[model samples]
Target: MRTKSEARKDAIMSVALEVFREVGFDAASMSQIAARVGGSKATLYNYFSSKEELLLEAMLHSAEQHAENVLQLLQTEGDFSQQLHSFVASLLTLVNAPETVEILRVAISVGGTTDVGRRFYESGTQHVWTEISSKLQEEIKKGSLRDVDADRMAMHLRCLCEAEMIRNLLGAHQRMSASEAREKADCIIDIFLHAYGSTR
Candidate 1:
């Protein structure tokens, strides 16, 4: 069970995310977040020292929720292809959401100019990749996957799953529907299984 402090902190993050999404990171202020959170600026500061800190925590909170869903799918007992398809579909749906796209745009726009990008990568993307890589390592030990670097394999899988869709998203193309995401995920998993399925 979460302690009162932890629950309150989560509440603050929830409101902070809403405020950030409304005005974006650059334009968003701690006062704005505090207003939405129903607290004084001092109270908000007790939970998060700076807007940047709050932003990172809020982003991590969202990413962690999606990561948990994906990790659960990855750990499920099932056919490898089925599991891969589920994971890919979940990932694509999460990444293609309008809020997520906006967040990515904000991150990219400020990535080179601030440490926010690095923090986001380390806490969000790298963390998910690490978890997925560990699962791949388990499959390798079970002789169900090719004997390869788990980290590299995980990266390859993500790249394949997001390939054209990510490109189209960055290019301002129409967002993929749920059905299209599933179809693309299936195609990517098929190719991945073909290339990396155990030789034995």
Candidate 2:
């Protein structure tokens, strides 16, 4: 069970995500988030120091939750294709969330001009690619994938998966039937194998 404080923090983040999505990060004020959360500005400040902090906190919160979910999936026993399917499914589920999609929109809205947003872009969201690369390395060590530079492999995987994710956000995909996602995973696995799969 979550403590009250933890629950409250999640609630605030959920509310903030909505406000941030509707108005974007810079345009959305702390007072707006506070009102959306049914609190006053001062109380909201007590939880998040500033709008930038709140934005970073919420995005990181989503990413941390996703990383844990993927870790759990990796823990379950599966063959290479199955493991890849699991990974794709997990990634799809997280990025497909409406709240998550909206949070992403606001993050991009910040653009690359500002230092704070740029740092968040590079270290925050960009860290996801690194995490995926780490997972790719783990899978390779387990003989689930062909040996390759996990960093480069992860970059390509991100491109493939993110294309689908972005389409889903645009309403061009409807969560992709599990079978469809699995097929996509299998295709990517085939490509990976062609490049680096062990040849007997």
TM-score against truth, every candidate: 0.91, 0.80
TM-score, cand. 2: 0.80
Across residues 79-196, which tens digit of lDDT does each residue of candidate 2 receive?
Answer: 7556766777667666666666767767766667445557666766688678777877887887766777999987877776676666755656565556776677777666766775
RMSD of 1: 1.9
Which TM-score value belongs to model 1?
0.91
Pairs that collide, model 2: none
Clashes of each: 0, 0
Task: Estimate, for each residue in 1-200, the C-alpha lDDT of model 1 and write its tens digit.
Answer: 89999999999988877777677788988888788878889998898778778888888888898788877998888787788788899888777777777777667766777787799899898999999899889889989899989988998988886666455447575676899889888888878878888989
After superposition on all CA atoms, what RMSD does each candidate show versus the true structure?
1.9, 2.9
The candidate maximizing TM-score is 1
